[model samples]
Target: MKKPQRSTAIFLLILSALLLVAMATFFYLKTQRQSAKTSPTKPALTVSTAALEQSLLPQRLSANGAIWPWQEAVIGSEAGGLRLTEVRVNVGDQVRKGQILATFAIESVQAEVAQAQASLAEAQANALDAAGNAEKARSLQRSGALSEQQINQFQTAEKTASARMLSARAMLEVQQVKLKQTRLLAPDDGVISARNATLGAVVGAGSELFRMIRGGRLEWRAEVTSSELSRIKTGMSVNLLAANGLPIKGKVRMIAPTVDPQTRLALVYVDLPLQAGAPNDPAAIRAGMFASGEFEMGKTMGLTAAQQSVLVRDGFSYVYTLGEDGHARQLKVQTGRRFGERIEIREGLAPGAVLVTSGAGFLNDGDLVRVVNPPMPPTASTAANPVPTKPQP
Candidate 1:
């Protein structure tokens, strides 16, 4: 009975200590909850807000290809078995139509012309004598100064001599043409792209002597998929970058009717401006150079936002919009054509919604953001009168 009384006293003391501790802990938790509710949450970032606005954006199609000549004209020799005497032009030389490109040693050809002329003169002298003889024979026919057979013989001789003279004249004309062929003349206005003629080199007839780009024109052969080819039309405006990064302006000249079998891509021929292909122009481009270009297909209206407002994450585009609760809500969006500093929002966005224009990449979902106005640009007057600085020691 004494041990049971001692144990009950100890249990009562422990229960009283536990009750006192539980009351103090409950009051401490109440104080902490009240303090947490009254504290201000710090913002994750400060950003500017912008709303989607309707703007006219250009519709464009991009393709990559190589620069080429609008039409390459091969210049070959017409004279056969002649030695090339002189080369008047080199590659990259600009030439005009009817300009003399090269000249051959004309001594031999001129001698042939002289020989033909002499032969023609002799034939003419013989023909004149034959005509006099025929007339004399016909006049003496009735007087019996010549027999009928003799008169016929004289007339036949006159006809034969006349035929020989006519043949000689034709030979002279042929020789004159060969003489003119000795001087190779340019057939069109162009820039020389190649030259095969060598001084003192014997070249065969119809052999290539030079190659030229007709009209001094250059074209961009844009390679486009079969699907993209359908949207292109003649006279469409094109902007291109040369291999050297020179900007070129052009117009669509034509589209190839057939697609390449291996690549299945069609060719779009764009006629570049004359200045862009002239040899003397500093911005001139060359053939066989890879380039990129875009065809302008006019403009259409679209909802655009500042390009910075959109961000790409995991290969998908996203934008942050401010909510009434003062936190960022990350929303996925579909993007399209891009203009100067704005981008087209194709889908997944509603008009008139405000978006974080800058510092969006630093924020995450449910991040508190402080909306602020974008800083204004410096005026010309302020830029001209910059702040003066003191010399450093």
Candidate 2:
């Protein structure tokens, strides 16, 4: 019985071994079938590329700034008295140089002028009479027909009358000039900025009445940081935007010699030209309207790319370049200055080299890419399939 049991155990062990082998074969076949069914299929990636070319770029710094008129002139009263009349020009109205803006009621001044004119006329007639009298007195004295004392008295009286006539004429001229000052005139061609005086209000001499921006052109006082200020110079190209969405082109007219101590900003004055083919009018731009500007310091010699074409991965910048064998070769790059839409490549790039302009982020090193509309097929080979390494026995 013990011998039969041992033989039975051995037979069972052999059957178990056969079953394990069959199970192993089934699993291996199943794995192979699944792998065949789900093999990775590579889809062709279409991309666009750009050729690198040497061009001018600018080193720019951005900062907040304000706008001011190119030629701001404060309108002030030159003569004291009451404001009697306001003219057609007010805030936002166009005015020409020497245009009457306002007037002060000077009834008293007018009366004084008339009085001085009358005094001048009377003095003129008296002076004529005095000349005749002096001539007659001198002739009488020469002929010995009148006493010397009498002739001398007549001569002194004539001289006194002539002096009075001259004084009266001087007074009349003074009154006329004063009367003209009562009418406020526009000092320059400009738009009225403010109207501080009203009819029936008294104003003192040198009092500020209205502010005007001289000339029809506008300007912007752009504030730039100390570092940025150094990069800019007079005559740099600039673009100006107004609060009302008006875009104007300009250039730097001047740069402040010293920066503001508190703000650490320097003022760059930009002169905005009138729109081409636009009619010139006095009411062009108002003073103190808010404006912003972009100044092109100049062309900076650096590699540049469109802002969308750059890629960032793992805290490093990268760009896809077409290698010699028609594949996307990823390269680490360093970038510098940025203009509106173009960025400068500071390092890791060469001029006149073609690179992937878009879709650089969706690529790996040595990726196989179909260049859409390329000039010619690249000479570089695509990446090869990675082989799996066998485990140690």
Candidate 3:
């Protein structure tokens, strides 16, 4: 009987311990459930949105190219084997037509001219004497006083002297032409772009000494793909982003006849506006600068949105549109030419659909979002309200 009582007491102690542990576990689980119910969730993200609208936008084709002179004139020496004595013009010099650009050594040419003149004078005197002798020979020809052989010899001498005079006169004219060639003159009014002529340097004929941009005219040669070439035509307007990040206006002058075999691109010539206003105007565009521009093809109606609203991912374009559930829905869109801060939407978006404009980059498909209204700027009346002059001491 004592052993049975001891076992019963031990069993009661074990049961009581188990019961206490079960109650403790139940209370702990209850507390956890209550805490989960009371805790707050993440707040929705605020974003700016806009409604897509259809509007008339200009159709444009974009291309990149380098600015170049319309015509580059090569200035060179016309006389060979002459030492350059003076180089009057330098690179970047503005020169007029017929302006002397350089001078060659004229001392040797002057000496040749003098020699030619002396020879010509001697020939004239000899020719005069020969004419008198020929006249005497003709007078004696009818008389027997002069033999036939002697008359023939005198006539031949006269002809020989006359021919020598003619040769000397031709030599003198040749020397005069050489003297004039010792100076290099500008062929047209232009700005010098390059110069290689050096003082005292002997240059050959036809060697380039300077390069000029004719009439200070610059042109933009935009290269476009072969397929886009047909859409562009002469007389279309163009707007280019210049080297200095300023806009330049131009017009399409011509289209290339053939396309490049390697790049499959054709050249579109655009004539840039001439520099106007102050010479130091910050808007001056220069040659050899790489610029990007757009050709205005025409106008058409297209759905448009802010540039930031469109996102590019994996070579595809998308826009996050707002839905009735206050969530963003990622919709793929086909984009076209961009104008200013707005871009054209060719497809996948309908007019009057609300789109996330500001924070679309951070949102994902079906992500919760809160549309935030833009803050109104302070008015002049509010700005003029002073705080009662702060009751100064």
lDDT by residue for model 2 (1-393), tens: 899999999999999999999999999999999998898435348788886655577644444455565667888887776565665567767689999988887787899999999999999998889889889989877688889898988888898889999999999999998899888888888777677877677888888888877765666788888877778878778876667667667788888889899988888888777441123443344446677767765565767887767888889888888876667888888988776777778788878767887676687778877777546654444224445689999
Candidate number with the higher lDDT (1 or 3): 1
Candidate 2's clash total is 9
For residues 316-387, write the lDDT of model 3, one tens digit per residue: 999998878788899999999777888998899877888899988988898888888697777898779844
Sorted on lDDT, best first, the list reads: 1, 3, 2
- TM-scores for the candidates: 0.88, 0.73, 0.70
Predicted candidate 1, C-alpha RMSD: 5.6
In model 3, pairs of residues that clash are none
lDDT of each: 0.92, 0.76, 0.88
Model 1 scores worst on lDDT over the 10 consecutive residues at 275-284
Best-to-worst ranking by TM-score: 1, 2, 3
User: Mind giving the per-residue lDDT tens digits that candidate 1 earns over 353-382?
Assistant: 899987998999999988997778889998
Candidate 2 wrongly placed segments (more than 4 Å): 1-63, 144-150, 227-230, 243-245, 274-286, 305-307, 312-332, 337-342, 348-393
* Runs of candidate 1 exceeding 4 Å displacement: 1-20, 375-393
